[model samples]
Target: MSSFARHRPAQPSLASVGPNKLTQQSLAKRLLFHSHPTDELPPIFLSETLPPELTAEVYDFIALALRAYINPWWTKITRYDKEFLPQVTHILVIVIRALELRIQRLNIPALVFHDIPTILSQHYADYRNALSKLSTSYASGGAASLPQLFSQMQPHTAILPDGKIDPEYFRQVFDYILRVCLPLEDHEAEAERIIVREVIVKVLLDDVLPKVTQPWFVQKTILDLLGPPAEGEYMGPLSAPPSSFSFHNLLIIILSVLQSFSGACIALIHAYKQAIITIKLVQHSPPYKSSTLPPQTGHTGPPPASPVADQSHTFVSPSSISTTTSTSSSTSSHPLQQWGSISAEPLTITQVGGNYAAPGLAMVSEVFSTRDRFSSNIFHIMLTMLSISITSFLDKLLPYLLLNTLCPAFILNITRLSKRTLFPNGYPGPQPQEPTLEEKAEIRARLVAWRGEGVLSYFLPLILGPRPSETLGAAVDPLSSAQCNTHLLVLLLDRVLMGLFPELADGLGNPSNS
Candidate 1:
């Protein structure tokens, strides 16, 4: 027999003891040998059946162990003790498979969602700390231990039975990694891209899109979350109202546009700064040398006539006259003489030729033309109107959006309304008796008072607040606050159309169902 088999205790024959006693002892031995020991073994064997709760607890424990310990090692440990690794891996796989089957049979949605998130969060925390330590150690020229590497990867193994990660958990991890570790080259580029893409896509489909299904609710929630659109007392210009469509589709479009705009703006600012630096460098360059001008010819008028008649010009020898004239001309034309003749110090020309003018003109013209084109586009006009209206709505609704700040009166009114809509008679759970008409009236009065206060504080801001400053001047000429207000109005109209008559929006805009 193998050494392992030899070490394992032998089973006693049924004849040696009553069957019940024999079975009890066998179970006790098995329980003792299990990775985790439980106190419920006696009930499990004495009754000849395992309690449902006990089975569930055992499976949960095993699942936790597999998720926390076993799976992490799969991607790590290039070399491990073969015998030990195989044995541990086999045991873990069996436990995991068995738990998966049990979970499937149970089909408990709430338990699955709740427990899975808790497990994932715990694993994520562990992995996060482990990854940090590993990175620090590696940076210090120390090699990562196998266990450390395994720990760093453990969170990734919390996959569903179908081998997919939990959608919500995946999104949480993806966003966390992007925010925290993405700047580190080693973490960001490795397996992160695939992981992020998968999680984001899944979350959009599962979590975010579902919320968009109810248009009015979505609009209200979005207004609550992001604050309302920036309109004043008057809503701006509007086109056809939005058709009836899924709220999720509209939110997706809105979010996409916001993200795109933000990214574009950042890129533009970076480019602008770089262009400015380049222009400065060019302008500061030293001036080029001018080529030498050709020397000027000297004029010698005919020699002055001699005073004596043909005793002519025994005045001076011709050679002497010629030599004296040449010397005088050379001295007058010398650089030192030219320098002495100048009265004003030479002006330094700081500007470079072929530099600023052409490029500056071109840039200005291009920017203006682009702005004009964008301003003329109907889509841009619409988007601006939408943004403004949304902002204005948020401004007016801010007070009501606060859960804690809402008046007790408003809460009572909401409770009454909820009772009328949902419960009819009263709430499901045992609670206080039905309210009297007088009490209800008092609640209503309080709600009205709170509502008035909310409207005053919130809506007043929209009317009285200063306009947003223009980000770009005439060069870019993006939509102004007023224009954006107008666009927001149009967007609301679009929302209305989509919300009330989705078939039309679907036909017009071709928005995705998701």
Candidate 2:
């Protein structure tokens, strides 16, 4: 019997209190012996499921183990699989929560959107310090302790059950992003954090934002979180945590927002073009006289889109149609002929839009309406328009140097508009003093010159008119030369086309016309 007892392998003490208790204790002992104590954690660490103390313990243990205990041997054994990266980031996120808790319990200043960079800087500094302490600990322990490596690591399940992401998902995203900005090799301890962030943000921004069905709301939400694209504009301090702290990602997002804003400007231009068509309908109608009355025509045909609309429906305007139909001398007497058309160099800017407002009439309505975000939204459109104008000006190498002097005034006008109070919710009904005759005349003079020798004219020569090589004869410089003088060309066409001959009213006889 003594020999049999010696030969038998020791049974796990299963005859404890009860069968269930024995089973439970034996299983616990098996796990305790097989894996690190921390590795035995439940697959999930959700606050909804776990007690606060348990959650805190899980978070603290994971962060402490990863950052404070770098085992070169253990790290070498780590597979560094992409699948497990998020787990590391998850651990880091927990750590962040811990820091947040520490701050809150200690009554420290809570972070805000504007404090992203500062918070990131702080987080990184804290990480480095933790790493430093780990390095010291590793050196003291001679880097050979296997148990220390396992001490805080919980044994996770083979298949981690999926669940909802934490409410602080945005914070987690940025935390992982911070790690991704660094290479995997430079920071061995933070590889998991980097991988996790890449997955989270990829799912949120790349995969989700572009979804065919739900992308609109998602994209708009992202834009709202990031704020506007304009730099140096004070975005009154946000009390909530910053959506993202990385300048690298922030710049990309800002450009996206700006691109959307640019589309809005183009859409506005289209609305103006449509308005112009409506105005033309009013202008060409019969004056309702017995002499002019004829047969009632059911179809006058669809009003032809303005030729100067440049094929874009957005540049239409009521005033522009009036300028088009009126006599040239009459148009010249107005404040600015062809206002949206830029004096009818046949320039038309197209409409643009995206998820926030679809690219057509809806977008136009958004800009014109003064309700909700219209004021701020319109300001963005205006800013984008000005930027586009400036870019076009530079692109053309700043044509018509004499007229370029007026650019400062245009810029000042835009600045003044930008600083004005927002339009009220319903509509902007503010009354303004009409322009004086002298002001009208001056503006008309500038408008006439702008449409002639301005950069628009310069581009028209290349884009639509004959090229320099295509010129059949010695071409007199349009801006300068004796060819500026022409009388019969100006007088002969007036009876035929009226205001359509604005080029004729270019002060052909004026010596300083160029």
Candidate 3:
């Protein structure tokens, strides 16, 4: 070898480095650096089991990186980073999930319950503040619309390469944010918690829904969030399949949204009614009466505990109570359990009963059965919302009543579901097993309970309440307002009754003729 060549230092080769000596550290940074494609997720994200250590590092890095993008005080990032956000969001979903799993496996409920939500709340506050600023700018004509304003204000985290908002991305975001926001236990200040919830409602209502270009995509997203309609499968009354979002969650969210609403109740109702109808179509059943557990014949264990003696305070069903306990346990064990584990046990009969029930029955309202505490809560909130809008804000109700096509398709679905419920054998298909006497009795009880506790308990009085104009007694002309409000109330009553009793033909006109 030549003297010059021999003088050069020997370089390390694969064999010289030795496999054991070579460190495989921080795979996330390496993966994120090289993978810039927006169309698909990086390999680390696609892996069934992600590296926990690396994932935690990636999550921290992402949280830091996203701070600049979501920060309210700094307007430094004005333009969207289209390529980075979509890919980063994919990584985020995976990394957040992996970190959640790791935290769970380590049996750290505090991190999952408190830290995650508080951290996420802080992030959401930043976003909300920035969004508020953006909204002000938009009002002054800074952008063409809300969608455009958001796209310009922050990196398009939910936007695709084709420059369209990806509904799935927002769904994941909503699911994650919502999962953390649940659990009635107060982890953060009340204001912070409210901010987090309001952000979700605003994004979904003000930003995502209106921007979606696809025809049915908005409706589909809403339905999925509210628990997709139950297929004609045989599910136990207590069976609640795990989902990313659920009807129970939706009710809580709607109630939260209402806290922020001044007069947007009609818009909120219009947005959710279809999803609610679809959910009720198949899930509708009578409220379950509390019964004593049958004594076990072959058991040598302590007898099952009796129901709580405080009949004045209605408790959620046993299954729901169990679900809350299970959720707490599962939060420390399973990652998927975090998404849709919230149950209705937190709701009390007094909270939802309001002043609608008779004075005598009001105190014993809990004695009656409800289809489910969550479903009952949904009706109560909806009734309150409708009442508020009709009596408090006639203008909002009248416009929605005239402009929207609320019932044509839903009425058809109502008829079909009614047929199935009233006459299961009427349709041509495999025969369903006839319900037992106990089942039939339970159904009758539910119907009676619904009559007393359902929307009709409040709604009939509201619709028939001294015409809305008289209730408001505002400067608006009473004659014109009365006519419009009455018309709107009747229409709303018709729709509400359809949901309450699918078999009822003339909802307001005649209850007995059907």
Candidate 4:
């Protein structure tokens, strides 16, 4: 070799460097050449370490990120990204769950703007604009034209051949929910989909209904929803072949929808209670009740000098006269001046009588309305919501809870479940015989007690057997009423379907048997 070539330094190969380059010593040496280790390490997320002053903005950012991740409307992100779904679910669980905790740790209000995210400001603005437009329509064209806004959305579409269902009227209900009521971000979140519904409901009860004042708006929407689908829609394939939709198809969906409304109902009931209290207070107050009394002499202005008495009037000592005049003026204003000083003066009997003719009549009218119209409307909405929640036990929820979520999960993972749960209280061995009326009554009573004791007390013992008494039974606390009402609604569907064929099923078996 030439002396010049031999003088060149040898370059290092991959084998010479070895696979341990990531070791601390080598990594430090590599990193030292470029930058400090702290600088090289991933920059601590700036947002995670933010100061308290920017907490609201942090929440906004999180909500926005959640919206992006969820793509609630399917417009923000594509649904084709199946692998990303789990990530979204976990993120949503964090938002739905961990967000409050994080906020608390940061020392921020747990409920900001009533838990309405700043990211939804645009959406709310749109909602307000739409509401205004709908209000205008109601005012101009009347209540009959109110549905015009929603009607713009293509009328319910049925899946021509197989989708024709009777009692399966979720097309409208689901539309109201997805399009209007509670539009969720994730599809799999149908089980937990409640945020939008709650928002819509609060707006409807507190904001929309109270201010709207249109009777038709309330009446039509309530009747339309609570009753059945109207004509020309969901009648199915307008042709020679006869077909009809059954309510059974959408029974679970409707019950779920109603169950979601329970919060709104509770709010309404609270308001109703407050209203009753207020009305009672008003009735007891001077405004609601009327009484008449004889006019009394005025203390001011020399008792309005009469023509005969004017000549006979005599002026006494200046000190005595002046003292009496000051006393009279101090005690009351003159009646002649009372007209101009109506606001300052105590209302007179004549004034009260005049008010009775006008405003009192109004109070009377309101009192009459409270007895029936107000109660009926309030109860109708409340009972409707309550019924939905109450009946959920018989619907699809119980069976699914028994068969899918709880039972299968336990039986598959925990081998000891069957012995403790089955055989004794539920299922297998003893064939269930049809009960007589007296036995059925006792069964009903027992079920009612279970409900009163709370869902956990009721369900755990049934699922885990008497062992649950050892753990969850000590002073049984009730589960959330809203949660309890959300049981699957499929079971009641059978009864509904059977009831539809009352000609055959009218008295075949007791309705309680369901």
Model number with the top TM-score: 3
* Candidate 2 TM-score to native: 0.19
lDDT of 4 at 4: 72
Models ranked on lDDT: 3, 1, 2, 4
Q: In candidate 1, what residue range of length 10 has the lowest lDDT sum?
A: 329-338
lDDT of 2 by residue, 1-514 (tens): 9999989997666554465344443222222122333234343332242244444343333333333233233356674532242345445554444232222121011011111122222222322333344535653554623222211121111101121223243443244324322334423555555544554454443333223123223233334444444332225665876665789988998999999899988988998998777555545532211110011011112112342222211111221112222221122111111122111223121211111111221222232221234343454466456646554333222212222343435534543332232122222224334457676444333322222232344543332223322321111111111111111111122222212222222222223421
The C-alpha RMSD of each candidate to the native structure, in angstroms, is 37.3, 36.2, 27.6, 31.1
Poorly placed runs, candidate 3 (over 4 Å): 16-207, 212-514
lDDT of each: 0.32, 0.31, 0.33, 0.29
Write down the TM-score of every candidate. Answer: 0.16, 0.19, 0.19, 0.16
Better of 2 and 3 by lDDT: 3
Q: Write the per-residue lDDT of candidate 4 for residues 139-203, one digit (tens) a residue.
A: 35545232332222111222112212222232322222232112234433543344433433443
Write model 1 residue lDDT over 276-391, tens digit each, in one string. Answer: 77555445533232111111111111111321111211112232122222111111110101121111222111111111122222233233332334333333345345545564
lDDT tens digits, residues 204-257, model 3? 434333434221332233334444233432244677678787799999989888
